[model samples]
Target: MRLHVADHPLVAHKLSVLRDAKTPSPTFRQLVDELVTLLAYEATRDVRTHEVEVVTPVATTTGVKLADPNPIVVPILRAGLGMLEGMTRLVPTAEVGFLGLQRDEETLEAITYANRLPDDLTGRQCFLLDPMLATGNTLVASIDYLLQRGARDVTAVCLIAAPEGLKVVEEFVGDRADVQIVVAAVDERLNEKAYIVPGLGDAGDRLYGIV
Candidate 1:
C-alpha cells in the first residue's frame, strides 16, 4: 500500500481552518468538501482511461476518456457521506456505491451495518471515501470487500489519519500492489477512545453536529 499526504499550500490553508475549534459547522462542512476535492485530484491519478479521437473545431485530436468500466465510488456511510459530493465532482460519470460501517465502542472493531454495491466489480477501479482513518479497521474491511468482489484497484481518500491507522492499513494490505491511500494529514497518534489526537474531533459530529 502506498500513502499520499497532500503537500499543496492551498490544501494546507484550508486544513488549518478546518482544524480550528472555532470554525462553525456550516463552514466545516464546506471546508471538508473543498479539501476532499483537492485530495481526490491526487487519489484518482491512476484511474483507468482509454484514448479516443475527437473532432475539435479546427481538426481531429486524440484525448483520453475514462474506460468503459466506470470507476466506483463507495462512501463508508455517515461520515463518509460527507465526502461523496466532492469526489463525484471530479468524476461525475462514476457509479456510486454505499458501505455503512461503524466502530464497536468496546472493541474498536469495525462492523458492517449496510452494504449496497455491485455484485461483480471485475475491471472496476474503486474509490473508498471516509473522513477519518483513526484505527483503519473500517477502511481495511471496506477494501477487502471490494477486492473480494474483483475490483481491479482500490484507493481510499481520508481527511485525516493517525500513524497507528496508517500502519494497520499498510500491514493489512501487504503485498497488494494496487492499493493506495490518500490523506490530507497524518496526525500524531490515536487517543484511548480511538480518535486521532490533535486531529479534528469526530468527523461525523463536526460535519453534522454531535450525534
Candidate 2:
C-alpha cells in the first residue's frame, strides 16, 4: 500500500474552506468536486497507458492512450457519489461502477448493500471515490472486493484521511496486489466517536444533507 498527500497550496486552501463549519451545502458540493478533480490528477499519475500513433495536421507522432480494459471508477455510494462528477471530468472515458457500502453506525463495519461492477475485472485498473478515510474499514472491505474479482491494482481518492486509518489500511493491505491512497490532507486524529477530528464534518452530510 502506498500513501500520497497532495502538496499544493490550492488544494490546502480549498480544503480549509471545505472544513469550515459555516460553509453551505451548495458551495460544499462544488468544492468537493473541485477538490476531487485536483486529487484525481495525482491519483492517476501511474494509470496504465500504451503507445499510439496519431496523425496531426503538422505530422504524425507517437503518443500514449489509456490501455485496454479501460480504468473503472467505483464510488462507494452516497458520499462517493459526490466525487463521481469530478473524477469523470478528468477521466471521461473511464468506465463507471457503483458500490453501495454502508458502514453500520454501531459496528463501524462496511457492508456491501449494492454493487454494479463487472464480475471479471481481469487487468482492469480500479479507482475508488470516497470522501473520508477515518476508520479505513470501508476502504479495506472495498479493496478486498475488487481484488477478489481479479483487480490487482486500485487507487483510492479521499479528500482527507486520519493517520490511524491510513496505518490500518497499510497494515491490512501488506503484500496484497498494488494499492495506493491519495488524499488532500491527513488530519490530526479520530475522535472517540470515530469521527475525524477537525475534519470537514460528515462529508456525506455536507454534500447531501442531514438525512
Candidate 3:
C-alpha cells in the first residue's frame, strides 16, 4: 500500500481549524467539504481516463475523458458521509455507492451492516471516503471486502491517520493488490482508548454529533 500526505498551505490551514476542539459543527462540516475537495484532487491523480477526440470552436482536438465502468466512490456510512459532497464535486460523473461499516468500540473491529455495490467489481476502480484512520481495522476490512468482490484497485481518502494504523494496513495489504491511502495528516499516536492523541477528536461526532 502507498500513502500520500497532502502537502499544501491551504490544506494545512483548513486542517488546523478542523483540529480545534472549539470549532462548531457547522464550520467543521464546511471545512471538511472544502478540504476533501482539495485532497480529492490528489487522490484522483491516477484516476482512469481514456483519450477522446472532440471538435472545438477552432478545430478538432484530442483529450481525455473518464474511462468506462466509471470509478465508484463509496463513502463508509455516517462520518464518511461528510466527505461525499466534496469528493463528488471533484469527480461529478463518478458513480456513487455506500458501505455502512461501524466500528465496535469494545473490540475495535469493523462490522459491515450495509453495502450497495456491484456484485462483480472485476475491473472497477474504487475510492473509499472515511474521515479517520486510527486503528486501521475498518479500512483493512473495507479493502478486503472490495478485493473479495474482485476490485483490484482501491484508494482510500482520509482526513487524518495514525502511523500505527497505516502500519497495520500496509502489513495486511502486502503484495495482494494495488492500494493507496491519501490523507491530510498523520498524527502522533493512538491513545490507550484507541483514539488519536493530539488529534482531532471523534470525527463522526464532530461531523454529525452524537446520537
* Among all candidates shown, the one with the greatest lDDT: 3
| TM-score: model 3 vs. ground truth | 0.98
lDDT of 2 by residue, 1-211 (tens): 9899999999999999999999999999999999999999999999999999999999999999999879999999999999999999999999999999988889999999999999998899999999999999999999999999999899999999999999989998899889999999999999998999899889999999998
lDDT order of candidates, best first?
A: 3, 2, 1
Q: Please give the TM-score that candidate 2 achieves against the real structure.
A: 0.98
Which structure is stronger by lDDT: 2 or 3?
A: 3
The better candidate by lDDT, 1 or 2, is 2
Q: How well is each residue in 1-211 modelled by candidate 3, as lDDT tens digits?
A: 9999999999999999999999999999999999999999999999999999999999999999999889999999989999999999999999998999999999999999999988888899999999999999999999998999999999999999999999999999999999999999999999999998778999999999988
RMSD of each: 1.0, 0.8, 0.7
Query: What is residue 105's positional error in candidate 2, in angstroms?
Result: 1.5
lDDT for each candidate structure: 0.92, 0.94, 0.95
Q: Model 3, 31: alpha-carbon shift in Å? A: 0.4
